[model samples]
Target: MSGVTDLVDPPRTRRPAITSLEVLCGLLVLAMLFQGRLAALLDVPALRTGSTIFVAVCVQAMPFLVFGVLVSGLIAAFVPPAALRRALPGRPAAAVPVAGVAGLALPGCECASVPVARRLIQQGVLPAAAFTFLLAAPAVNPVVLVSTAVAFPAEPRMVLARFLASLLTACAMGWLWARLGRAEWLAERVLRRVECHASGGSRWAAFTESARHDLVEAGGFLVLGGLASAVFNVLVPAAWMESLGGQLLLGVLVMAVLAVVLALCSEADAFVVASMPGLPLTAKLVFLVVGPAVDIKLIALQSGAFGRRFAARFAPATFLVAVGSACAVGAALLGGA
Candidate 1:
């Protein structure tokens, strides 16, 4: 009887593991259940300020993000990979500086550059060149330069210094990556080729799907970064900057850090740094150079697009190079004023 019962018994089924989607839904339900408590908690001055910063970052970035995805989609649909390869130099090393220079044509902020960079990679452009464009588009564009000129009307060299420094950073990083970067560092998703004509889909269909996918994937990271930036902004007192006036090295480091924490839009960061009193010109230059190249917001976006491994390596390297370039350019152009 025992043998018969054992034979009749079926294997037990395992429970399914929870997915991110399910966890997100659970969080939404929890938030809905405790909306009053959450609202009350956020009423504190610090929390309120953080919330405001988060919202402002998101609002300022969304339009540019949307524009990026749209451009990415257009590239996927219309720009043949062969044409891109033909347009650029055959060697990745040679293409790097060219891509950096091409960035001058795009007037959008960092948010707009990420998707375009990713799309360039998808379209068979080398990672080094794409990365160069990513850094340069936001920092060296005409719009950013004009804004900087307006922000520091008396110091016209500030604009030139920023352009040269940022372009130098982009090209330097590109060459570095071309020499030493490993393909395995980037996520498979970034390198994977999407079938634009899958199931005989139209180019328009491909464009819509590609844009929608990027918007959904990258947008979540953007929000996450905004939250992080907000928390950092609140924790770092504004008064701390005023006290660092005489400490050149310390001021440069702190200002560089502030650039990452603040995550200001590139078009507006010049004005923001310009308004901050007491920091030396070198420190201010570092802030301008580093902000567009390696901020908390850009880090989050890079992690989402290329994977955490890539962001971890690429972001720190970019930050260091940006600081160095800014300091050198500032000394040469501003005479370390």
Candidate 2:
């Protein structure tokens, strides 16, 4: 693969968002090559503002992207996927929380989880249990924990709140899927792709190989998402967010849209979500809960691991549950919407 292709991929396809960025970038390059009308596009204030927002999103997500890529590398190395496969809970009843707690031990992004979870399924771990851990572990890992602690410095409770909400939502969704969901909803290819590896390699080799593979894959996605989000911000108007702010449900929808649109890594989402004002605590909570389970980057990873059909069916369901949990927790914590 080309060095660029080695890095892995976004979900937003909004014309205004994606198009404006592309046009502007193309224009800038063309401007350097041709000048005149290409540079004149910036004189249109709205378009100019959009480009600025897109750039801002890209810049803001950089730290999270870097951290996620490095951590994904570590997971590919020190943490053996098989280590947890053998230890997963047997019964679906007990498996969900076990999976959620297990998240603390395994390190990776939601992207990494798809590959790892698929491995567990192949290893004969319960699908429900594996899926639960897949949803939770990325958000509850040491990296996320540290990021959460740092994001809400004004309120120590925010850290604890995020942990509790994430744990609850992950386990709850796992249990729900265990009881009512079907593994057939997942694609066969995901199983084939994620577990198709020479796992018998030495630990060091496995680590380096896995890390390099994951880093390239995840990093590639980050760059794509970064550029895309930057483009969206530049082309789209801030008024879109303002409309979302007016109604509570609308606010959550906005956050959900942002979750999908921005494609922020789960480890880094806490800070980004935490920074948005005017969004209800419940909506923000949904941002946290749904981000790890069903954002754009995650959707791509899930597609690779579970198949597009399975991911489509699974993500919306998981997202709804996470939003519910976030809303419930926000109500309890803040005493209302």
Candidate 3:
């Protein structure tokens, strides 16, 4: 009774609370949605289109965001960080192809893979292979596979082409990174900040404690990106895309660049793929393949996690490889198309 009395009512102390950026972003998005200022800066077509796209993308992305955040939180809460280290091998050469195959099992879209990849790296997985898995999984997973099959209902070859081309690209990037890249380039936080520091009882407690907050934070950002996508799609001109014209090489380059800018998730990009009219089959293929691997949102995440310099170099190189793979696959397909 005396000890209990002593334990009760300890000295009061103030602790600074960390606020999430997502809340601020979500508020700002709502503000933008209500603001009627587009008429002064742009023409009606662009305004209507962009705004419509912005709204549609945000709505469309909600389910995905929920799924992504929930899955990410689960991985954070339940799956031991040690499990990741065990799953990934140490040798880069062996890890790369293995990771490509592992992608088939992970069923989420591109957005979810980012957090999961971060977790894998924190758990001491090889960066090259982790990166490879991040690139490959969204494109190869059952959802995308089924969607690809449905989108190209006529052509089993299209599905096969998307799968094989993407798999090859992911493997190639991993091998390149393993051989030529250095781990030192990774951001200090990425190389450090592991999630398993909490002890047994504490770890379990901390997970549930943090998971709710983490889910909200991630969901908020996903909403922001989705809204941005809607804005771009609705406001921007398809004619601008048509301007890419028949220049096959140029079209591939343009689509690769757009993939970075548009930041469309891997799961929905197939529909986007079906929509683009002027892009050659090769250019469209590049769009589908490169999108999951690296995009504007991913670049931002990578910059924060792996540093801006590493992001700049790695992202562009990945883009180049994506373009090449798409061209090779496209040429083979279009030759037959």
Clash count for each candidate, listed in order shown: 0, 13, 9
What are the lDDT figures for the candidates, one per model?
0.91, 0.68, 0.73
Give the top-scoring candidate (TM-score).
1
Candidate 1 vs candidate 2: the TM-score winner is: 1
RMSD of each: 3.4, 10.8, 6.5
Evaluate candidate 3 by giving its C-alpha RMSD to the native, one decimal: 6.5
TM-score of 1: 0.89
Candidate 2 RMSD to the correct structure: 10.8
lDDT of 1 by residue, 1-337 (tens): 9899978969889999998889999999999999999998778999889989999999998988998899999889877788877878989889999999999988889999999999999888999999999999999999999999999998898999999999999999999999989999999988987435443358888899889999999999999989999999889877777799878899899989889988889999999999878778889999999999999999999999999999999999999999999999999998886
Displacement of the residue 102 alpha carbon in candidate 3, Å: 0.9
Q: After superposition, how far is residue 118 of candidate 3 from its true place, in Å?
A: 0.5
**Order of candidates by lDDT, top first?**
1, 3, 2
- Of candidate 3, the 10-residue stretch with the lowest lDDT total is 209-218
> Tens digit of lDDT per residue, candidate 3, span 239-281?
7787876778788778887787787767788777777665577
Tens digits of per-residue lDDT for model 2, 1-337: 7877756554557665565558779877876886666667567876676567555545655444445445544554555556655576568888778878988976666765765666566555778887888888877888887887788777666666667778888888788888888767876743442332444556557656655564555545555555566666566666777566647878877787777767666667888877777777677777877787777667665665467787788878877877777777777785446
TM-score of each: 0.89, 0.69, 0.78
TM-score of 3: 0.78
Error of 3 at 169 (Å): 1.7
How far off is residue 306 in model 2, in Å? 2.5
